[model samples]
Target: MIAAFLLLLQAVAPPGVATQVAPAAPSAAMPTASVPLPPQDWSGLPILPIRRSATIQANTSMYVHGEVMAGRCAKAVRTAQGWTLTLDLAVLATPQGRFRRVTPRAIDCPTVEQYAAGVLVGTPRDAIDLDDTQTDTWYRTSMTFTWAGS
Candidate 1:
């Protein structure tokens, strides 16, 4: 599923624009279990639908056009049981309308270590698609994440 997302991202913004977030230190913590994505009947080929009025926000003030967002992403982990990968991620889709203010770097997610070390972990990930409508000011997307390599 991630591969398909990556391919879509590539088609949208190219691989160079797509970024990743890795733990400062690899953890031995294994994934609890693996869950598979559900299957659904479709009329034709698998295609992610786009939203025309989508809104995405970053940081405390950054805003983007959700229509331009090609895809979302998360982390990659491995479990001993099934080599299961635990992906924790966030995404933000830019809104269509213009914003009074926007800070591109503010949307990034910070590292846990950075926070623990007393550093104000600013935007750790380049962009975080907030699930909260009031806080993030964005809407949820149809990612349909399916477990792979399990």
Candidate 2:
């Protein structure tokens, strides 16, 4: 009777049924989360241009390279929070290639004078001056125009 019962148990069970079942694994470290988006636009809307003022300055050797060079000043307009102004040492007709350098005090004018003179916010050592090789080292600068709310 005992041998018959053992034969019945062996027939019901598989060879390695205990080994087949694995223990549950602990969960991984909590995954990192993404940053929240700004409360502004999420739709693929093109940004409408804000009419900010612009001032462009070119180097002394600007016209020597057979290129038309000029310094430009544009008028400022009012904005919602505050007005913003832009100053860039840009090339007019030159493609994605070499151009001239506009030093910090290079293009001094009444418009950019107060901002430049107040306190150079973020320029590197000695301002954006000419190196021995004469390439434009892009040091950063920023200022707030509080005089006329611009």
Superposed Cα deviation of residue 32, candidate 2 (Å): 60
Indicate the residue-level lDDT of 99 in model 2: 19
| Candidate 2 Cα misplacement greater than 4 A, ranges | 1-74, 90-150
- What lDDT score belongs to each candidate, Candidate 1 first? 0.24, 0.27
Candidate 1, residues 1-150: lDDT per residue as tens digits?
Answer: 434533443355422332221222334785432222122322232221233432323321111111112222222233453222121222222232211111112113222211111111122223433232332222212211122233
True-structure Cα RMSD, model 2 = 31.4
RMSD of each: 18.3, 31.4
What TM-score would you give candidate 2 relative to the actual structure? 0.22
Among all candidates shown, the one with the greatest lDDT:
2
- Give the local distance difference test score of model 2: 0.27
Residue pairs with backbone atoms closer than 3 Å in model 2 (clashes): none
Model 1 residue 77 CA deviation in Å: 7.6
Evaluated at residue 121, the lDDT of candidate 2 is 21
How far off is model 1, as Cα RMSD?
18.3
